[model samples]
Target: MTDCDFLLVGHGIAGATLADVLRARGHRVLVYDPGQANSASNVAAGLMNPVAGKRFALSWRAEELLPAAAAYYRALEQRYSQSFFTETPIFKIFGSPEEQNAVLARSADRPWGDFVASLTTTDPNLPGVHAPFGGAWLQHGGHVAVRELLAALAAEGHRAGWLRRESFDWTQVQFDSEGATYAGQVRSRHVICCEGAAAVRNPYFGWLPLTPNQGEVLDVECADLSPAQVLNRGAYVVPVGGGRFRVGATYRWPPFAPGITAVGREELAARLTVITDLPFAVVGQRAGVRPAVRDRRPLIGPHPTVPNLSFCGGYGSKGVMLAPRLATLLADWLVGEAEIWPEASVQRYNALQPAGVG
Candidate 1:
């Protein structure tokens, strides 16, 4: 059997980032990804959100996560000589007077004061848009074209002789206290499972409370909208280059259904109508299942009993914002230099883990 430092499953943002993090530190990494159609990272717009929801509350630890994530993507962009991440400000239109008031109050406080600006009127230069209740200018965050980024990283990994373009069968994996061996073809010093929404089927981590959710987004050509600005009114419209914009993301939580539907398309169109009245051509629609968790936090770190096996997923809608930072922490933890953040550690559910079967 061939030996390697890590054998990663799933090449979504979680796996791809974790693979790169570990590889950068001098580990021999082999990633398994057949590029599943329903992979969330593939279908995500990869928005880097600093402020979340209607309350205008600071995204969980935005102070630490946002800047570092931008830097990480920038560093990779430089190394690969490819562009994917873009720093585009989101113009959040207020749907009600209450929503406008929340932004006004939050933008006056410390930190929150620094993240957004309450806008009383739409900029005259930005046309094809109208906000009746005013809006908020989110001063931080951007978007990552996830599919391109993953392909670029995978190309580098393949060139370096580390990536595998095949599915990993659980039946062929043997895990012991020491580590894991796959099909007796590669003996891994550590195995990390980054399976996005598919983590519900992970026999090794079934107890982690992984909940899958489906979301759909539409690609439309809007020539009149500002290409540099992302506009949101509950739903978002982000420019994805070539004069085309991506509008989307309707959340279908738990009871997890699969695939795209006409209903989803109609719902997005209605939401987009509320966000903007611009004339546009519908170009495409895509759907994927988000690897959401019941607690709505990430799951990282090694198996409680197995020791060498680990997990890094369940970032859900926040995958782009959280992946890099969490991947760095997991990399350090792998080398015995640090511990996973307690809030994000798989250990959080240790009390619920059934013993002797990790």
Candidate 2:
């Protein structure tokens, strides 16, 4: 059997980042990626906003994740000789006077004041935009070119002999205290499943509350808008390139199919309507299933009952901002250099099954 220190399933952001971190620490990691259709990383807009929701509250652990993501992605850009991460500000349009007041209130708070600023009454000078109630500018964080980053990571994995571009069969895997053997063709000291929403089907990890979310995005050509920054109302518009902006992300639980639906498209269009008046043509549409959790926190670390088996998924909508930082933390924990963050540890779930039967 081909031997390695780690066997990674699902080469999405979580898996890709973890493999990168471990390899940097001098470990041999093999990644198995079936390349599933509608994987979240492939379809995500890659927007990283420090302030979230209408209340404009700071995102969970924003202080740590923001800098960590920026540094990690920047380093990857240097190593890969490709540009995928862009640091830009987000202009959050207030839908009502109440929302505008909320931003003002939050901005005066201690740490929140560090990243928030109220925009002047003057127009933002963007055509086809309506923000009568004004908006606020989030001074930190940005978006990543997720599709490009994933492709680069996959290339890096292949070049390093760490990536297997095929589906891994759980039924064919045999597990023991020492390690895991897959189809007798691969053996590893630890198996990390970064299967995203598909982990809900994994027998060993299905028991965890991996809530699958169906999200959709629209790729539209809007040259009249500024590509220098992102626009946010009820929805977000991210400038991808070539006068095309990526708009989207409607979250729906259940009916977790990857295909786009008429309802989803209509909802996204309506949300975009509130953000801009400039007419834009919808050039493309995309959708994927994100691995969300009830607590909205990521899952990391070894299984409570299974030896040499670990998990790293459930970054959900925040995968781009969360993956690189958590990946380093997980790698450190795996090599016995540190402990998994309490919120992300799998042990938080009291009902982890001994096997996937649940």
Candidate 3:
């Protein structure tokens, strides 16, 4: 009978970040993952965009999450002696006059104004693209190499005796007065489920309103275009490591499947055609289900029915930016040092529950 402090279900960003945090605090954590599931974090471009394009509004909690995310990634890079995070500028091309005007109008609001640069009349760097009216530069926003970071963390965890390559079985879990037990290996006091979109299957949290979305990305090898900055038109063309670039993300709701479809490919090609004239080769196609919620906020806290079973999933499209600070908050709450915020806490959805029933 082995004992551990935690049994994390998913090896995606949410689980990886939480495990890293707990391990740093000298708590032993055992992560169980099969490595076959398509996690949204794995498909994510990991770009941290402070200013949202649709509404021209600052991302919810961007002020707090952005800096913390940067610091956290940088610290991890230093610790691992690797470069996983890079500070690249995002060039948001103007799609229409209304979009440009919206950005200008938002510039007057202190913090938002501080993040967005003065709207430019023309783009000098990448021409022949859609820049009829030009675009604005987001100063601090950039991309994190999520794939590299996760791989490195998984390796480090294995070396430190904190990660296991196996799928979690609910039948092996036992709940008693002390806490939860799994496979006769009782470690830590609790188990935090970080199983991205799969959290819908969790009996304790299955009731939470989840609106999962299927997202797809194309890895295109474009040798003609070599811009150092990320290009954003309707879709983003983010430069991954080496000569390869990532272009994508078509959001589909409802009948969501993990496989890439011809419709998604057509959608991406159409969007890419609007932004670039260079011929590109589609080397890879990938899809994953994003654990989006009805309210679009993250669900974090202890399970209502079983107190020892906690959760920290439902990051939606902003997992890279939101994970660091939220992980800290969850860690604090688990240690009984702080109370979870009502806005982000799972209690918000629990409020809709019938009285006396979790």
What C-alpha lDDT values do all the predictions have? 0.84, 0.86, 0.82
Which window of 10 residues has the lowest lDDT sum in candidate 2?
A: 349-358
Best by lDDT: 2
- Count of backbone clashes, every candidate in sequence: 0, 3, 5
Model 1 Cα lDDT, one tens digit per residue, 1-358 = 7888899998999999999898889998899988775578989999997887777778888888998899999998899788978987788877787777767866878788677754674443467777877777787789998998988988887788788788888778888777888997889889998988787888788878888889999999878777878888778888888889898898998665578878888889888777668888888999999888878889999778776888899999999899999999999998989988999999898777777655
Q: Candidate 3: where are CA atoms >4 Å away? A: 125-128, 241-243, 352-358
What lDDT, from 0 to 1, does candidate 2 have?
0.86
What TM-score do all the candidates reach, one by one?
A: 0.95, 0.96, 0.94
Residue pairs clashing, model 3:
3-186, 3-187, 4-187, 4-188, 5-188
Residue 120 Cα positional deviation in candidate 1, in Å, after optimal superposition: 2.7
- lDDT-based ranking: 2, 1, 3
- In the range 266-312, model 2's lDDT, one tens digit per residue, is 88888887787778888889999999998999999888776899999
Q: Rank the candidates by TM-score, best first.
A: 2, 1, 3
Give the distance in Å from residue 230's predicted Cα in candidate 3 to where it truly belongs: 1.2
Off by over 4 Å in 2: 352-358
Error of 2 at 332 (Å): 0.6
Model 3 global lDDT (CA atoms, 0 to 1): 0.82
